[model samples]
Target: MTEPQRLSRRLIEQVGCSRREAELYIEGGWVTVAGEVVDVPQFMVQDQPVALLEGAKAEAPEPVTLILHQGAQVDDRSALASITPASQAAEFDTGKRVLKGHFRRLQCLAPLQPGASGLQVFSQDWRTTRKLTVEFNKLEQEYLVEVTGTMRDGGLERLKRGITHKGVELPRVKCSWQNETHLRFALKAPEAGVFAQLCAAVGLTPLSMRRLRLGGVSMGKLPAGQWRYVTAQERF
Candidate 1:
């Protein structure tokens, strides 16, 4: 019987590839051990049939972007729980296969406010992280806010025209009633508690808030608590 050895070593011996190439194939989910895909290069194995998948490439996999529709009442940790392999939304079909390495080293962007829910973005790419963070102010976010209570005279107009806070005059935003109980707000991402404060100043109490769009991306038909990959064709 052959002694157990590192999977990368076995792949090197079997395929006659260099150490770096073996690691790339293993990390890219191209190599399988005993019919199971093993992504870790250091995985131990002995006398197991190891083979690379058909059309396997040694190139590094592209970084993935995940968009989650966080449900209301979910905390930060709980919202991230939906990122697991099984929690992927089955409705959105894509060519990208679920890989173990895809979950590592992810950076969360633009976290939702506490007790509020909507689109949550996470990415393994530095460019995406920078676009959503460093250049975040340039993007407009659309929120559907549910509120209760009557507005004071000219309160709606005040919100549309913007209000002064902490002695600073704010820029006007596109604020209008979506219906009797909901308001559509189109503006840059505001600081934490800013939305609630804005609603309060106008004699309205926010019952719930859900972001519908950020920049060019919209939370279209993404069910709450499920996540889907941002397609390559998607921008912003």
Candidate 2:
């Protein structure tokens, strides 16, 4: 019999996922061999049945990521909701069975306020999830915001520094006035309700807000309430 091999490599072969993903599972103590958790990627395993804990074993469908052009009208519905048959975006019906707790229960990384529509990136792929959520600070989310009302003196500078809202002091973001009524805001770490807070902090009443770009992805020409697959060549 051959000597044991690296647990991470063995897990990669068993799960058929990316090497990084396998390493993540192993390092997170999600991989088990013979009922023992294997947290070390370098652990040796020969013929033991490599088992992945429930949450760690989930795999997204082949296509992985789905890009939805959510509309400003359906503010009640999120981009992730488009995967449902009842959703107006019927094109998302790929007929692929995404196993339990797939994209259904998964909330979108960004929550678009009702009446504001724009591009949204979501995926059943764990890699995408990790990149979007865990490493979100590295990302920049672009938005077109239309507002009514004048700015508070130094509001633009304050917004650039960061607008303290609620109890916490929010992080700084890139903001510029596009026109008398339009403004462009690029948020790096988008905390919940940040868009609205930005408008409020700037002494502007938000008339409309639409996400134009998320990292390297853009809304492009896709009509609202519709969706398209993210091609393999594209990277966020």
- Structural similarity to truth (TM-score) of each candidate: 0.86, 0.54
Candidate topping TM-score: 1
TM-score of 1: 0.86
Local accuracy of candidate 2 as per-residue lDDT tens digits, 18-112:
88888777765578889987666788988888888987643322435767777777643544556542432445444543332334444465555
- Which window of 10 residues has the lowest lDDT sum in candidate 1? 164-173
lDDT of 1 by residue, 156-191 (tens): 789888887566666567888999999988888676
* Pairs that clash in candidate 1: none
Q: Give Cα distance to truth, residue 148, candidate 2, Å.
A: 0.4
